[model samples]
Target: MSKKQEPGAAGRATIRDVASAAKTGKTSVSRYLNGEKHLLSDDLKERIGRAISLLDYQPSQMARSLKSGQTRLVGLILADITNPYSVEVMRGVEAACRQEGLTLLVCNTNNELDQEKHYLQLLSSYRVDGIVVNAVGMREAAISTLQQANLPMVLIDRKVADFACDVIALNNVEATQMMTDHLLQNGFEALLFVTEPATVNTRLDRLRTFLQRMQQSPQCIAEQGEIELSNSQGLETLLRDFVARHPDKHKAVMCVNGALTLQVARAMRRLDMTWGPDIGLSGFDELVWADLAGVGITTFKQPTYDMGVAAIGQLVMRIQGNTEPVKDIEFSGELIARASTAAR
Candidate 1:
């Protein structure tokens, strides 16, 4: 007699539970569940049916779609889920997926190239209809492999080296230039651009743009530095040193992103430095806490939600067999001036 495993928590019954109840291997259960009952004996079919009834097991749409050859699932890979930028983009992606009646599977790589590769493989195994990726931008080989596999993919904010795809991102050059021009228009004589490692394409673009713009405008002295979030003391030391070097001049810090902006704000607080009059501050992102940071940190607000929606929309077009040329879609970031960059 086959053991009957009962379903728990209503929809909590897994394929493993069904197989166990039917006293069969997972492969056999999968074959039957995918509507290949003709391949199985009547006895096996009756047993599987009885098991499903007893357990009240319902197969997932993805499982059912395996037989239909279209899972209607999209994979979204984020470099770091903790970043507010990623969260905002995800909200838009989720909304678009819901409207399209598709499911989304999200993977957070924590900005690791290896993790990005791993998630790429994982998503591929699930036979996702398409993929939206905000990558760490180092996994060129993996990205190329996926591209070669003919999977529909959209790059968000970050572009992989040598792997051409539809990229939906901010206009890094224009936005960074705008921020730099705004800072120069103010009375700040010196600028310190602080950022994470310029590893990703977007970061690289912004850094390069800032440098180019500053070079064109000799009115301000500009310097770029990289910082890691893991070391607060190092950031503080860097901030202290930069401030100490510009004692007589009015200087401001230009953070690369919201994470760096938070770190700089904290470092300023630790050093008892005030924004405006003495020092000015501005960054790339306008986070939820941006206004709360001292006299409010100045920022360039990226259209993250729209970018997300655009990425998914492009991916869907690709999934539907659109063979048009891949073109990058860029959005502009708005500069929001605040007391952080106010003149003395």
Candidate 2:
């Protein structure tokens, strides 16, 4: 009989023990277990399989990940988590990750490029499979670093001018054009475009589209044509002055996003300007209190949840080695006509 095996002395079986038991080299066992079967002979493969079964060997996931260089984890970097758009997008991303058996780690950059870069480097160091960025701007060096590491990434709700990556964003130009056309057809001659700043692509696109639409129409492109206001006081003063001067002309205002829309609404109320009778209002990114503000502000509703889900899907595909070329996906905004822009 063979020597009796000790009970407690038998430790966990490693790749070396498995190879020795199968009368093969450690490299063959490593290759076979890692699914690199082309390097092993059929006889050796059978022996390794038998040895693995007899020893009840289990591979260490940590060691396997170190060798394969894959974390099966995803990182999501949002510009601002407080924004409803970001929150909705995150919901979709989480859902997609759950379906794909991947983990999601979210970081809020608060719309800061430096913070975004820091998170990007941190995530890369942690060996995340990919990242989804929804920040305001992009830095070339930050993007190049990820590329150099062969890490997959996708942009959500924003786009970089030169960086070639998958992007999921809104159709800002079309939405703004549609909003402008609606206001024009409804007989609102004096229109104001209120926004935060024309820095990001979304803001710039909407402003350009609105200006272009106004330029084409001789009646709307007068000397006092489109009033572009940046701050709350400036916007309020401009609107108050416009109303005071052009009481005969139907006054209508368009806001770029939800935050600007809130400011516009407050200005209207503070200046004692009625919505339905005194002025007409419409804005983008329909907020929760949009309808509850007494005056129904007609606005464009973005598909926030769907955007998040699509961003995650694209990143997941990239992580899976589906690198054909960069793709840009745009989601259309829905036009909600309300009492604010009601025809009198």
Candidate 3:
């Protein structure tokens, strides 16, 4: 079936067309269109108005924004839009945008350095009032663009290491500390922290805090490891070896994010390992399946939606010309205790 074309997809009216129709120069048409009619005589206004009506001309918002310096658009660059954390953040950002009467434009980087640089440039080109960046890295190209970009940017959940900006993130130190203490209190003495590369601040903080807490627990056995989300076999092997090495010990695995949580859970299943009895499982982002999996996975539930709303609040204020010192806002998370971390 042939698809119908959108309105004005072909041969749409332009200011020049209106000007030609009205027997006036483009400046006169534009001035009239932009409500600078005082600069034009009554005859010019009438001719422009009649020509606009006859040609059904609609002015482009992009063109108007270029001249006015306000697009009423907020740009958002996300790491992975499909991540549960990102999805919640988006909901909050979208709701806040609606309340503030601004539109949202989003680009996903999928945690790729190249894509991050590309999307950063693309969003900057849009002339957004401000940006909410959940950035992956601050490599030279991205940092150069960020340094030169004048619009305000609010970072979410992760920091671009050296750049100073308002940051809205989970209290990683507090959350990870509390969760680690809980695991220790429950007697999960052998603990392994599984994550993707600790490249971003969130992972780095969590890994650091977990290691710190474990160090303080005199009897606790602690280890750190990384998993490639694409390498299920490697994850399974890592889990199997973790159990084999810590034989007869009460063991727990802490995943850094929801996507990794699911990956770890699946890898365990493939190895005929159930979380609660075979090993304790704890993670960061709370996903629905966390409670539905074999004996439910324990998670430190981040206030992702609230973080999103807060990011927009910060961005909107900056767009409104607030030049206060760069603020760091950290939201706290609650641990959802499930049987996944029950005494093993």
Candidate 4:
């Protein structure tokens, strides 16, 4: 007894059926369907077109994509989407994705390694074409997982030196150096570099650059002052120490990012330190309060939007079979000098 055929089985035209109807090889039909139009002659193109129209064939995008091993979707894993940097980068990524006709999936890890790893695993399971990770610390396991899966990944605002992937970063070192130099040139001698932790690449690079630049001047070298804090409690402790230790010296502190800046502002209020005259300050990234904070903070303005745009562009390129080795793109951070760092 012969089994009955399914309703669409015989009616649906595969590449083989199209090729047979067009009097051409299956390879030619496959290539043409995949957008390799250059391989087909005018006559062959017409025959294939006629065959497809006659069969009323509708290609299964999912099946074709699976066969080609791609989904045309890019995933972005951010440390914290609340950060202005992350928000700006996301904007750029969305714009680029829209232009390329690709989809974007964003995941916020809140700076947790385990959460980041979980999101990475989820994105991989979804079979996304590529990923843009703005992660903290270097997790060899995470990098290895993505590499083993053959996913094209890019790092944004953070770098894992050992990981082989494109990086979209701000010129953290250069920007810090420039900000420190400006502080020095403006005659604010007592300098302190305050940051969250040295684990992330951006923080480490900024701290290193600030230290290196300050070392060039004998005054800063002699002081040897640096403050590293993890949370708001640590920030409070550091600020109290600063107030107690530098009662006489005019204080000029540099914060790594906006979160740090907010903490510093709160710390200043608690310590009763005046902004412009008594305590001079500058921050790495600008915040919503940078302008309105009791004392406006001078800050290094990163092109967060541009970084996002470039990251998406890179992911799209990788998806398009650009097998070129990974690259690191760095954008300059602008120094927006404000009242906080005004000279005495």
Best candidate, lDDT-wise? 3
Residue pairs clashing, model 4: none
Candidate 2: segments with Cα more than 4 A from true spot: 1-64, 221-231
How many clashes show up in model 3? Answer: 0
TM-score of 4: 0.80
Model 1 bad stretches (over 4 Å): 1-64, 138-141
Residue 224 lDDT (model 2): 27
Ranking by lDDT: 3, 1, 2, 4
lDDT of 3 by residue, 1-344 (tens): 02222233468878877787779899888788777899999888888887788777899989888898899899888999989899999999999999998999988988888998887778788777889988878578898987787779999988876788999999999999988988888889899999998788889999999998888987889998997889988898899999999998999999999899999988888888888988999999899878888788999999989999999999988998998999789888999999988864
Candidate with the larger lDDT of 2 and 4: 2
Write model 4 residue lDDT over 1-344, tens digit each, in one string. 02222224676767777777789998898888889979899999988888877776677778877898777778989888988878888999998889887889999988888888788889999999999889865387776677767888788988886777899999887898889888888887678788775777788888888877877887752132344434656667776776678677767888888877777888788777867878788888877668887658898899988888888888778877899978889999799998888877
Ranking according to TM-score, highest score first = 3, 1, 4, 2
Q: All candidates' lDDT scores?
A: 0.86, 0.81, 0.88, 0.80
Give candidate 3 misplaced runs (Cα > 4 Å): 1-60, 63-67
When summed lDDT is taken over every stretch of 10 residues in candidate 4, the lowest stretch is 1-10
Provide TM-scores for the models. 0.81, 0.78, 0.83, 0.80
- Residues 1-344 of candidate 2 have per-residue lDDT tens digits of 12222222348788888888789899999999887998888999998888888777888877877877777689999988987778888999999889887889999998778888788888988889889888667667766666676678888877787788888999888898889998888888888777665667788788888888898887863222233434667777877876777768887888888767877888899898888778898889988877877768898999988888888888878877896889889989899888899887
TM-score of 2: 0.78
Better of 1 and 3 by lDDT: 3
